[model samples]
Target: MDMDTFWNDFQLVRTGNPLVLNVTNHVVTNNTANALLAAGASPIMTFSSREVEDLMKISGALVINIGTLNTQDIGLMHAAWSSANAMRVPVVFDPVGAGASTLRTSSSQELLSLYRPDIIRGNASEIMTLAGEAGQAKGVDSSLGADAAVAAARALAQMHSCTTVVSGEVDIVTDGNHVYRVNGGHALMPRVTGLGCTATAICGAFLAVNRNRNEAAVDAMALMAIAGGMAGAMAQGPGSLQMHFYDMLYSLKKSDAERLFSVTRD
Candidate 1:
């Protein structure tokens, strides 16, 4: 997509302010909420199984992050996915640290088999692990590059019939057949916590307005990279970058997006 299309999608988030329901991990809840708000999207984090049904009815999209999963949260995630499917709302799944442990791997696989998410975002190792390939994962950090996981990501996307994203120095977004690589984020982005989780939330925000899952995934990654790059230029370190990141996202203009946007299709 071009800068014009990207700006149009960005404008939709501001004008519509679509409500996004996130059943995300505790660690990134605040960061994800703040990122969504900065991008002009309403965020509601609810894990109550009873309330999720009603919340899905009013929400435009749902985000499921397994960063800090438990038996109860797993059941709640299943319920939320069911509600989202029934309501025909888009769902973004972030299988954080998928290859880190047996539980994480199994939980991600189980969710993928149970419900077809509209989008799945993770690091190279996470996506590769989900694809049933051996991957190197040091906790949540990916030891492999995004380029190395392209084939695995494509396979996973085809198997699940959804958009798959592998985030790294160059973020790779694919929907089985088509692929897009977005580049621009700063090196310091990984130093901060919950940025990947925040990216998944941003994907939900973009999917709320865009019907094409591939475009929505591309748009979200592009926005993240652009904002991160801009913020990194002024910040002294990760701490300051985190603060500036929010400010850049809030004040991000069409011109900024037009100037900073970079993507290549495969």
Candidate 2:
């Protein structure tokens, strides 16, 4: 779908207020929940293995975030993902810091191998590592460029049969067949560590509302970048930007998204 229709889906998601189940880490729980509500989606953050399957059964989509990884959390994430996939609910995966630790990196890959997600969002270094690069990562921040790993992203997408999104100065979204690049974001976004995880959860909310998530994912990514850009202009720095970011998200109109959106397909 084009940008206009993308906004329509966001509106549908807003009005429908699809219930999105999140199995996220400790670091980004608050940001992720706020972002989901700001975008007019219901956020349900639950990690209890006892209730995860039941929650996924009722929710619109499932979001798995590896922001805070542990042995037990990994088991719950795997169970939630398995249930979500079996039910055909769109699943989004965020491998927060893939190359940071052997356990984190291995768990991320294991999840992907076990249940390929509908969409996966991460920075260049994370994507490159997920695509089998040997480069080191600086904590969760990307040490690689978005453009440098296009081939790896594509390869990963095809191999996993899942849409891959690489966000940097410019964001790249690909579904193995189609690739879109979105430019227009604030520099302050990277300063906030959990923003990327928030974006992945936002993508899950988008997939929840639209039946065709290929288009919904595209729109979600573009709208997120656009919102970040606009909010950056209105704020002093990352602190204020975080507060202003939610305001922009809550006030976002479909018209604004279409008007300011910058997209290109390659």
TM-scores, one per candidate: 0.99, 0.96
RMSD in Å for all candidates = 0.7, 1.2
Q: Each candidate: what lDDT?
A: 0.94, 0.85
Candidate maximizing lDDT? 1
Candidate 2 structure, TM-score to reference = 0.96
lDDT by residue (1-266, candidate 1, tens digit) is 77877889989998999999999999999999999999999999997898998899899999999999899999999999988998899999999999999999999998888887999999999999999999899998899999999999999999989999999999999999988999899999999999999999999999999978999999999999999999999999999999999999899987888889999998
Candidate 2 per-residue lDDT over residues 1-266, each given as its tens digit: 57777777878878999999999999889998999999899999986889987898889999998988988899999899999889888899888889888887999999998996888888887888899976458988877778877877788888898888888888888877787888788989988768888889988988887756567667788777888988999989899999988988899876678778888889
lDDT of residue 39 for candidate 2: 87
| Predicted model with the maximum TM-score | 1
Summed over model 1, clashes come to 0
The weakest ten consecutive residues by lDDT in model 1 span 1-10
